[model samples]
Target: MDPASHPEQLSVVNEQVLNSADRSVTAAVCLRRFLCYGSESSTYSTKECPLGIENALSLMQLIEGGRGSEVVDEVRRFNLEGRAVRPNPGLFTLAVCSQHADCKTRQAALRALKELCRSPVQLFTFVQYKKELKEGSGMWGRALRRVVTDWYNGQDGISLAQAVTKCKHRAGWSHQDLLRLSHMKPANDNIALVCKYITKGWKGVEEAYAEKDKSEDLQKVFAYLEAVEKAKHSTDEQELIHLIEEQRLGKEQLLTNHLKSKEVWKALLKEMPVAVLLKHLGKLTANKVLIPGSPDIAAVCGRIQDETVLKKAKTQPFNILAASENYKRGHGKRSKLKWEPDRDLVQALDCAFCKSISTVEATGKRFLVAVDISSSLSSLCRGSSISTVAVAAAVCMIIAQTEPNAQIVVFSEGNLLPCTVSSDMTLMQVAGLLIQTPGGSTDCSLPITWASENEKTVDVFIILTNNQTNGRENPADTLKMYRQKSSVFSKLIVCGLIANNLSIADPEDCGMLDICGFDSQAVDVIHNFALDIF
Candidate 1:
């Protein structure tokens, strides 16, 4: 049976704290719950497919039945009662609302996420889109250097010319900061206008330039503000910020792509219903097309230089109908290959990625991670962690799988993707060696029981997942078998993530010292969790 088919044969707990409790206490409680009951609450009706706002609760309740119905109702009751409770729930709820088709729901989610930025964890979300932080050796670098160089200089006029001169020798800079800088305006007699703008507060800069707009972009924005001001009802700052960012997305036209992708985006845009002024700005920004995917594609090409070798790999395209066709477009090709792909195409490809993503960066500490993608992982793609999951998965790909020279193992029902150091192979190249497929159950014991049945002194066996797990037979059965076999060594560690309030039995099954949720600094968590497991 699919391991997911059962309530993971695990124990469970508090489940209530997520909604009404203090975030700090809730955070701590949630972790403890996972440690205490890490596996419990098993039964038929206990499990029900989750839906809407009450989703995560339903997942836990699924292992329990008529009581499960009670669980669902309780979750809803908690929701309504807590209407006056924690505002953070809004942050958690909006993410799941992506599944909803209405614009109001989506807008709410986006707004909540934006508000989360004020929190310390804001940097986690920020890291994903930050392709260019204030780094050196580029135009942006020059721009920043320019600002730092003259931030204290010229008590008189700090012209754009001087700023440019400062950055002329630098190589890179922060695009976001630079963009913010460009929007700052000075007062008529404001000595060192930049400093003046900064001192007078952000409103001062916007107000100073609010009326004297030079570009069409600024004009549309001013008009939007005017419209909003005319409205009798005042909107909150978050609502205003959401509209502005929407305009930014529309302006960049980043969503312009395939028919399906475009249609979905358009529908979402309408559902979001930004002000006409915001929509207008989006359209204007959309029109200013950036260089089409060239530099990014070029960088990718440089990563994989073997033309002949890469050509052979494309012999298979899982999705493209014309994937198998021999296609190339280059100076040295036989028959001048038609529509062939360029190198560094992994960005678009759904291949297995590892943690060593920044090959260009320095070497990182090495470690091992063993994950059971058998079930439970559905949590990563659900709840407030969904977006975080994708980003985390990408990071992991760079780490674990990126090292073709490292030893790696992936186990799931009757199958395993395992590698050993051979004379001709390096573990760093392992991620490139296997294709991942989600198996139905945590039948990992089948192969493990076979391999270590007679061996001793084995390395670590870490299970990376959301703590809830159910097996066809019993995960415990495998644990017993594990103990019975193995002439050498055995150490087991289970990393349960966001599994607020887990339940477990036979304390021995869980080698972890009652840990729950995830702490990013733990090297094991860093190496094992999906790149998307943020």
Candidate 2:
């Protein structure tokens, strides 16, 4: 394979090799992006959207190659331990991986079924995916039966009641349908009664309660289920409020019309989790419960300010950013609902994002943060109102604020635009400035070329972009040229702002990394990568 011996043939062979390597890198990047953010569509948003799951699964299989089992194991552990935001992607990936991986990995992946299927909807999705692959009613294997049985019987009576009540049906499969298919005999009287409710509704559960000699635990479960049934049918707000307070029912158990009641919202605010509160701030405001000087607003702000609650909920910074942006806009992203956003509530959301950032010690290395402001990045991120350019700006600011010795520059095709990023500049201010900056075609190599020409001694160069580079000089080769000129072994991190498969980092270089743009742990990850801590 010593191509140098034949100079004429070496040119073609080298080009072919480069093309093959680029294809492999693109596949790997696509697989990673699909796992993190579902779908191969270019719509990159900050919301937890579950779009094109089946399509994403097919793409993963085509690109996964030999690493299917490893990726599945990692995703399973992360989702099972509640480290990931939305568990549906992980669950779907595990199902797909089990079908394609080796026998042992298949067993290991399937063992996580009960833990991963926390809700009835998730269980239905999982079952649907598994069944779709094999077209037969007789495809229910022993392992499938065991897992389904364990999923129903493993939860405590109260948790099971909440699960059945909150999600009656999903993915064209009902709890009754699943119960019938599994033929699962209940392990306890309480579980048995919940199953009865799932199969025959409140009538069946009440019938059992009237006839059976049940335990106090079963009686309590019966009471909770009865409250859920009443809450579903009741039009009286006061009675609904009483039931919510007494039984600790979530907003899901209530009827849709009752959600408009300000008193009901006030009651729900008392115990709403930080995640749910952020998601529904618009609805709360539209109902006038979050008006100025309202106690409901105070309660919500207090919860948002609680760092403990934020951490426990594992709320991502992007979620807060999207909430603030959408709330300030005073309209739903995909709904007709409109409201006047409360100034105090918006401030609290912004502050919550700042406080929620994970603190990490700076590596004290010289850094160059290059952000791409191309026109392609102007699209609104998939599930949020914020633009991809703004998301990039917010992420860049996070890094610039953390590291003391960092300089930022904006780049397009032939320009290295002026960047006024400062430690004191608010994220929104920086975003507005960057978005206003005139953009041209994307050129990812501008950072490296600029650093070399300016004689900047940078230990790390971070490029935030949509990965659509059109420069003549390859960024990888430019990095090598920069290393030769400055005699500094600079590392490159390509943080993709949108869900594109292209990457600028060299796959062969150990000093380069390709990561998602708005990863909640972006700052810590970048710092560690710079310090060689990974």
Candidate 3:
């Protein structure tokens, strides 16, 4: 029987053979099957393709079982003959570094890595792995040093220096490795300069080279280094002064640049003059730019000293939905910045939403904030480490704060559980509480059904979800029924945290609005819809 034709049957057969026959023979058969069918399976684009890095890991596991010496020899031959490596270089690097790999396997893995390092991108990976996995290990370090030396010898000095710098800064190369490479025979003056700048303090470059002989080459290098230092200091001081001056002038460009900086934008926000701060607070709030390191935005909101600014802040068409989508796509991960908006700032932002409601005073309206805490919501938002649930919680907190009569509910499957949200609770705290709530199949109708069954009169139903709704009853049908029975005009706003084509709103219903993401503008949308003003 051909095992290659049926992988499932092969798995079962392999499992039975392992239990009934010699372990080494069973392993060898498994290895051969993996090499043939496994390699082909890895090329398949389908999600069900079983052969992957895990398969390579499993093969290594078998080799480590003390009976697969032949398999080890086969792998070494694969490396020696330039045959297709079972796993790609990145996965192979991770696999071979495991403690489970025998000495023979490690040697073969290193050889394969050496070949892979011929590509500049792969060389960067080698440097990263050296720092992450095998730091200070003599064997791995020597291997990498040799590969780098060979690469440097073949490449132009300037290109090689740029590649080294890129690897050092972006790939997390250690100073020690960079220093060693700087001293290699093929190393150019540019490479040495970059290495020195990274490894030594900028101010102490002269001190580091104080003892070197006063050759013409050395003198020229010293002059260039000093000039570079002067230029950097001059640029920094000028930029700082220019930014301060721009803030004083109440220039919009300063706010634009600040927002574009992402996490570091907080620095600009904090340092801006008070006049600039007050002038741009509305723009900042409307854009939903979370000012880092300061609660100034909140302070401005609490003071409400300028009613016009408050009005603008409340009504600005800020897209929280887009921001939430960007967060999910992992935009904030590289910045390593946590989303820790000040409590007052959060309250103030929520208040802006509250103020947007024209029919009733924000403090007097009855709000039902339903957040989907389904299992999928726990996953990180794009470009951000912050979970989708966390963003939803923040939105919920904002909606709840507008009215003292607000009720927050977390729904999953057919369950609707009330959430205890205090005004003092941080977004993180709200998120933590929501995460603790039990999750099941998504039922967007649960919250609506609960409110209708209990005779609850909700002015607005704010549902925060990824729109992957699977429920016994359609949410749109349930919402329609609730609106018909209610004496008060109710609005349904679906805030999608995930970017998908599917929407839960009825296209024909004017009362039902679909907003993508947890944007601050959602409150305005809700407020406008409730009053029939839009």
- Candidate whose TM-score is highest: 2
Each model's lDDT: 0.33, 0.71, 0.51
> On a 0 to 1 TM-score scale, where does candidate 3 land against the true structure?
0.40
Candidate 1 local distance difference test against the native: 0.33
Q: 161-264, model 2: which lDDT tens digit per residue?
A: 98988888887888888888888889998899899888888897777687878788988898899899888889888998999899988898887788879999
User: Which run of 10 residues does model 3 get worst, by summed lDDT?
Assistant: 39-48
Off by over 4 Å in 3: 1-364, 380-386
Candidate 1 total steric clashes = 87
lDDT of 3 by residue, 225-291 (tens): 4433443344343553444343221222233343443333444554444334533443454345645
* Per-model TM-score on C-alpha atoms: 0.31, 0.78, 0.40
Better of 2 and 3 by lDDT: 2
Model 3 scores what on Cα lDDT? 0.51
Per lDDT, the best of the predicted structures is 2
- lDDT by residue for model 1 (192-262), tens: 33443334533564678655634554444344433233221323434333443443323222222311232
